[model samples]
Target: MISDAPFASPDSEPTIRVQDKTLLGFRRSIDNIDAALIHILAERFRITKAVGEYKARTDLPPADPKREEEQITRLRQLAAESDLDPEFGEKFLRFVIDEVIRHHETARQSE
Candidate 1:
């Protein structure tokens, strides 16, 4: 009988053992991807922070609706091409944009 546990027991079938290894491999890949995503997000925030400082120095507005709209559209198209959900892409971009705008506003206030 097949066990419902995540990992194969010592007496489990060879196929189940192989499946366990395969599952581990997939999880490792996912972990690596998650790590890369975090690094990329960190880099993006760093650049956005610099942009906020620059905008504050130059007396520019914190939020650019036109640019945000363009980004949303572009991201949606990219998501569709990548077989991802456009709405999810837009939501992610909006969340990041909102955080960036908040940072910019704080920078402006300090200027």
Candidate 2:
């Protein structure tokens, strides 16, 4: 059974009722989704790393403002359609874009 209190004191041990299995089920689903997100991010970074290598070899700019803006626009629209916050989607995409650009710049310097 989950605690009636929404939050436990930081120093207190969490109270759980073993008879209440619903919370466990929900937590398992959350864990699975978290794992999937990690795998997806890993794959995305692998592809972006290859793109960075290609851009480095071809002397292309590490950062593309036009492309980034287009992606943010698209992501925001998609997030809105999915009932998510557009601003959050844009922020998340911007963070990833910044990291990718950093990797590209590092690759370029090493070339």
Candidate 3:
């Protein structure tokens, strides 16, 4: 079960009710990591939003397939070096890239 307490502040550890101490510890770690990932993704989108606006203003195409492919290749190699699943990394990146393209398209339509 999850605690009622807010997990907003990193300094304040989130509480969870679990019978196993080890499992509770793991859960808390995962929660913190998940929160951090959300923050990271938010930042990424903020930058991408700016890029979308720039692309729209410059009348540039929303999706660049060559750049996307190059990024996938580079990230897959990095994922392999980090002992993470390259395919998963590529999928995650692709998802983000697709969303960015959608935002860019919207921006273009508004222009």
Candidate 4:
């Protein structure tokens, strides 16, 4: 019953697509965030890998309490500067730092 020309064609109701479009938007937004988080994790892993290599090459112990303390201090400063939850950020950094040290240990043992 509609004409072929643009002016006479049946116009679609936008709200009819709202639910599907919102779901797709949510999925895409989450995918973008997940990709960014993966990138950050990859960078962290690369740095940890480098540390592992260094420790392996130099026969250095990975657990340096003094160094870790220094790192904690630096991280706390960064959290404060960035207006993040300092305690939580420091704890998370410490956990990841310990994980890096464990990786270094594993690398050492594999050699």
Using TM-score as the measure, which candidate wins?
A: 2
What C-alpha lDDT does candidate 2 achieve relative to the native structure?
Answer: 0.90
TM-score between candidate 4 and the true structure: 0.66
- Provide the global lDDT of candidate 1 against the true structure: 0.91
What is candidate 3's lDDT per residue for 65-111, written digit by digit as tens? 99999999999999999999999999999999999999999999998
lDDT tens digits, residues 24-100, model 1? 79989999999999999999999999999999999999999999999999999999999999999999999999999
Give TM per candidate. Answer: 0.82, 0.83, 0.82, 0.66
Q: Which candidate do you rate higher for lDDT, 1 or 2?
A: 1
Instruction: Give the winner by lDDT: 2 or 4.
Output: 2
lDDT of 4 by residue, 1-111 (tens): 322333432585333333465767898999999999889989989988988888888899978899889988998899999999889988898888889888989999986
Indicate the residue-level lDDT of 54 in model 4. 86
- In terms of TM-score, which candidate is stronger, 1 or 2? 2
Clashing pairs in 4: none
Clash pairs for candidate 1: none
lDDT, model 4, position 66: 94
What's the true lDDT of residue 46 in model 4? 96
Pairs that collide in candidate 2 are: 1-17
lDDT of 3: 0.91
